[model samples]
Target: MDSLATTLLSTNLPPTDLQRDSVRQLILNYQKDVLDLRSQYRGRTSPLDVMARREHALQSIAAWKVVLSPVRRLPFEILGEIFVFCVVPSLRSRSTSADDPREPPILMSHVCALWRNVALNTPRLWSDLIFLFSKSLPKRGTVPILEDLIHPSTPHALRTYIDSGAFSVSDAPDILQQLIAIPEFASRVQTLHLKMGTRHLEDLLYDPPPVFLHLETLRLDICIGRRQEFVGRILKFLDSPTLRRLTIRCTYWEDAFCISLAPHFPWAQLVNLDLDVELKAAELVRILTQCVNLRQCGLFSLPDHKPRRYFEICTLPTLETLVIKGWEHTYWLFEIFRFPNLTLLDLVLGKWPTEALQVTPTFTLTHLALHCTYDDTEDGLALVLRFLAQSPMIESLQLNDIHGIGLIEGLTYAPSDNPVLLPRLEILWISIASWGDAAETVLRDGGEGLVQMIESRLHPDLRPSCAPAFAELWEFGFKCWKPKFSVSVQERLANLEEDGVLTWWE
Candidate 1:
């Protein structure tokens, strides 16, 4: 017989410590006892004794092997990454990775001695700690589901959310209870996202977790309740020195500035701040003054105030972009006397100036976006046309208006015959401007005809007699309202990359 031992080894999984001594000893004993029994029955007279001994040895081996191989060991780093993969948003009754049938590292224990040692020493393999509590559980039955898959050295990042939409405090107590019981849990959360109903916000504000240290991105979506307390708690949490992005939506308070934040607090390091609120003029101004390093800011539902000539030179001025919506022109447009470095300005007008105001921007404004409710009259449009024709640096402009500039009105050519303005403007938008409204006044014809006229005037052989589809006269803005930083821009940016206009990494 061609070594029955070789056939047996091929049929079974390698032996692990759990089955090491036992399986090895059984195999060895079978070799000797069965051979002896066979030898005694050499004449084939006592075949029963040999057959019985072989059967007993095989039975012992199978019984010992079954229970021996369930858990596995892995290298510290490999196990760390593996455990990280297991963590995710939790739901009730089922595991977060139930859909992923890939055998978890847990199977390594069933392999052999070498594999078990690797699986046991890896700290990262045991760090994902999750508690899943759901309303579907039996009335009197409660079980705490916990999992920890963390490396002792690697910092942890956790994200948890409670859809208190359908949950009552009585039903979703596990979320808060777990948090309160384990204070260390907050320290491990580097990226925190909490979205819950109005009822639980009160509890958070009263004795909230100080979870801001070392935080990088914070997104909070809470239903309105006890607005002042909620706002205060937010300011309290912002004491974090490491915060980079802050997003708050759907104002829960009567006014944006009622809750005060410490200006000197190390919270001003944030790069992005988005506020959706109806704030008093002073309060809005307060934010602009304090967060001098803020790179991006969005404000909606602005306060209605007289355009005051407030020109206090900002001390820590590095602002690059400002977007103001629901603007009540009761405030002065040129009053923004100190944006020496501002590159882009987006204003949504609720009201307009009583008259066309001659304005000279201090900085080289490259892009300007206007959401207009009022149309600049012939003279008003003339003032705007003159400003654009003079700006040597502006390259793009977007104007969204409800009313239209008059036809055959606001005419001021640069140099009579070759009078084409906004030479640098590459992209033009007339989202709200009607061709019929401004006939020969703005541009001789509608935008299309005007573009041709502008191109004809571009120094005869600037590009060796090459004419573009149209001239870069009026690159206008459109009211294409959509979510911020959405997927739509991804395609737009991709096209720009193909055109070689912008570097991808930059």
Candidate 2:
């Protein structure tokens, strides 16, 4: 056995058939010998030391056999790729420290000598770095340890996230400076998220301004207030030719400042933009007119105030997704702009506008989500149904905080000779905020209507023969503040969900 092991270790080529047979026979012989020894000791009381020696020998053989696994023959590059897949992309920037064993990079290094060497050499494993600066500050030796973990010569782009939680530049200026001063750290940054105040931004934007050559995504969360000029300067300093996605969120409301600073951004070059600052109707139009290349845009708040003067219609031909939260006066928006290529519209409204639906142009929308804070009115439901009737291409619909049994009944398929509503609909999610007795009654009746509507869409034989081959509903979600579904209804829904006809969640 010793000679055979030495021969196998000396060869770099694949084992021959004879050598393979020899190895298998040797393993079988060893197992037979072990079984014989166990049979000999079956009824006898063996000494503790002898028993321990036998167990240790068996464990040692098993451990040594693991070295002969086919995985051991994998090239370093293939092994490194497997290790890279183990690193979760979402959790990459959540690694706060170099020594966090829970993180994949650190955990892989602790497995074995080969894994440690491969993990340290693979630049992708250590590219994402997160630094949390607090009032206590990072220890003196922390940066040096992090520097040692990251490969010095690897050219991989880094995704960096720095959250200055309650820490000002005066508290720990050296930490941020030291982190960026790391060799080739700034130039290689592909994505950056900074949750700091204006003071930190001011300090970071120095005389020459930092240059991020490969930056594609940048998210800034300014938690404190500062002068409008300083905000403009920060925006100007952070602009990069490679940036395509940008998000700026200010804790304090800066409606006017955002409008004034809008042109400072390279809006024509941006593909995605999100602003948390409130914007009036005219200001929103002014900003959208410049975002010519934007595909996805989000406005955090749209105040109810009307535009001061008449402006030409703003058209966004490239925009596909629009998300507006805490908005009112929806008519002002639909009246001022046209989204010819818009496919998704998500709105969180303070009040449902019946006039906006009337003026809104017909869109080939595929997804629509409407969340209203107030209770649904008959006029609102009628207007919504009218709006949906025109959008025959809609595939997914979500209604939240609405209690409209009439809307559900309207959506139910009728046997009479009438046109179908949303024939292409595949997903429906409705959430009702039931409060009083009247609201509960509405919720109960709406639940029944929802079931009937789903069944009509799911079962093809139940549909009228003249009806077009509509897309089957694949998902149905119903939520209420109070549970009002009868047991029979619940069982039927459960059986449908169990059979995977459509996903049902409440």
Candidate 3:
């Protein structure tokens, strides 16, 4: 019978009519014999036993299907890498809940036996944890799930976020107690992002911090209702030797300077610093002097009154990227220091200087982003163009919330014969928010000035001598709102897009 079955399978061509009929008859005869045998023993076999055998057969088939699945063939390492990609974003953002089905690691583990086994063993997938301590303690009952997140076997450095921003006093203690008790949890944390409220701040600040030997990045945002009490006390307990990135923001007050200047903060080794505090020019200059190795720095909403005494100039030798965010009176802070190696500058200014300003020609700036506010006037555009003319090496320029339509016009009417304001600007991004009424009103020109600026830069005459579109530029981006686009302007822009000169979205 086996030989006959093999012979039938081996034959590639269809069997003759007689051969097919014979094979069908043989199969029918086999079925009849099996039924007859079952009938003879039907009464002898127990009904329960028969049902159990059938269930066993079905389970065997299901198991075989799983074994033969193509996904099962993937090596554990490759499968683990796919799991990392799935959960990395969730871990970074801390948006997904513990039981959220969207979480890749959790979803992958529940797929099948093989996947569950692989996910459990892959330590890196379980290393990043987001524990939000709120009133409900949503994750309190899921200790087993939390264990899976911080797997015992996974020796990877943990990136942990403890958010108590929404927690009430009554609920925070329970979660904080539970989290702090986890054996070896704090010591393994390499990147810690803590957002603490008033009550949580009181509890955590008094306690000793865990040894974060491997910590590299620390983002601390504290908003205490009673700032005066904590202002005098320093929370400089967390000092990691390998720490390179530090971001600190205090919503209640500008007491970050007090905490940061402490000897235990390890500012000297930092490579990236993002400080959102209202500090004087002298105070900020004092902090910059310590961060010798800082490569990127952001100073937000800093208010400094120019002192009568001569303030020594602070030089940031290693700084490459700097962001200065302020309203009208804050532009003077830029003059305090000479950033010799700074390549990128992001300015969010409410008021811009109209007069010609001196920029250190020694510094080679390649990228500049200007985020304009409603307070900015039309002449501010000309002032910006003048600054660009000085820093001719700038390759990328981005204008966000730009209030004036004359910005592009200002650059167009430059007096030079080859009037390319930004000679090296390869990318230009202009964004006008829907809320900016002044911008939307003047933009009724149907974006003619924008078209002209792009045309001048892309023109054959300006291409060879000045900054050509070495790469395609994002000439314009209308984020949420659309301006009144005229037919002629749209048609012209469409042609440029087709020729691979520029791209815009509304």
Candidate 4:
């Protein structure tokens, strides 16, 4: 009997704490209370043990009460708001996973039950969907998963991202129709990103829902089997007057997809247009004339043409900012035709001397960037100095993928035949990706001496003149493009810029 009492009282606890289960805990406490009485009656416990037993006996009645329990309540609404900021993509950066094997964000929903519920409930969260169907689905398969994800009961704020490849065209028609069939959701979709390469997606878009009427942004990336038919149907579907932002990327070269007007394109209502197509000087120029209300544009790499025929006469009258990724140097050296209200320009050089800078209301160019590839940094700088000499009123400049100040190549800085210095140049930044002889050559060829001469030649007593100086400098690059960034108006070109790092003031 005493042995039974001793055995019941024995509690060999593990080193680690165990989570408390209310039911099991109550049972253990009750057993300990009954065992304590048996041990005391048998007189088998010491005074200390007896006192510890006394404590439990006193606390047991209340300890076993139903009051000990966790309160079950839902998470706060603000917790969902935090999740929104958690998925914000960088405004200027987007990593491509179309070709490469990259993971998508859908898996985030599978992280936890609560998170999945929250993510599913937050319709805006699922709006940026990126899925790649690499494997086949069951015969009665894929439809259910997709339907449930975008059903009418789904939060109507869902945006759409449907990318099925060339082989998926048959299934695409079904999928797209299903998507279009969702009446109320169709109208809520603001951005429709459809990229089906090697496949004809236009056929699937046959009965596009009025959802497109409310869509303000559209992106089509294609490696079409039939380029003309593909483009025709695409343009046909673009009957949306409210479509403000359009981005189209075709497998064909830049010129292959030059601009064609439906008379409605330049409705003086369009705001942003990004074209990645094959283009020539004339084709590019004619297309520019159609974008009367275009405020921002990104032109991805164009083939180089000689004799400066096309771009020489191109005009961008209402363009506020322009981004061109191509051989900027090859652009005809004649002159820019027109940039009446342009204040921001990001010129990603492809070929050099292809176009020239025709000066306009010159002082209006406040934000300028020359991302070139020529090693003759001085030669290019000389060309620009000459270019600026003609314009004379740039506010800030950023140079990427190019060597800084060619003043030192034992060459003269802005040849003295009436030089032109930036009188209002308040911010300057020079970015170099490949660290090579550009730096060594300067040091070896008395680069410091040359810089001193140039600085001395500029307004020496130049204070920070109502503007910032060496305001900002840093690095920026895209994809596998060589990583490039640097900043030194220090011993090189002081009295040169504004007050932001990789950023400029005014």
Clashes per prediction?
Answer: 29, 0, 0, 52
lDDT of each: 0.48, 0.63, 0.59, 0.51
TM-scores for the candidates: 0.55, 0.76, 0.69, 0.63
- Tens-place lDDT per residue, model 1, 380-480, is 44434454554556544555663434312333232335443454544444343454434334344425544344344333232322223323334452212
Q: How far in Å is the alpha carbon of 178 misplaced in model 1?
A: 3.6
So what's the TM-score on candidate 2? Answer: 0.76
Better of 2 and 4 by lDDT: 2
Q: Would you list the rank order by TM-score, best first?
A: 2, 3, 4, 1
lDDT of 1 at 8: 34
RMSD in Å for all candidates:
12.2, 7.4, 10.7, 10.5
Best-to-worst order by lDDT is 2, 3, 4, 1
Give the best candidate by lDDT: 2
CA shift at 291, candidate 2, in angstroms?
0.7
Against the true structure, candidate 4 has what lDDT? 0.51
Name the Cα RMSD for model 4: 10.5
lDDT of 3 by residue, 87-166 (tens): 67745476655444566567777776667777788888777666666555444543545555666336888887777646
Which residue runs of candidate 1 sit more than 4 Å off their true CA positions?
1-185, 252-267, 306-316, 328-337, 349-362, 376-380, 386-391, 402-423, 433-447, 450-506
After superposition, the stretches of candidate 2 with alpha carbons farther than 4 Å from their true spots are: 1-30, 42-46, 91-95, 98-103, 134-138, 145-153, 168-175, 253-262, 279-283, 349-353, 404-420, 435-450, 453-506
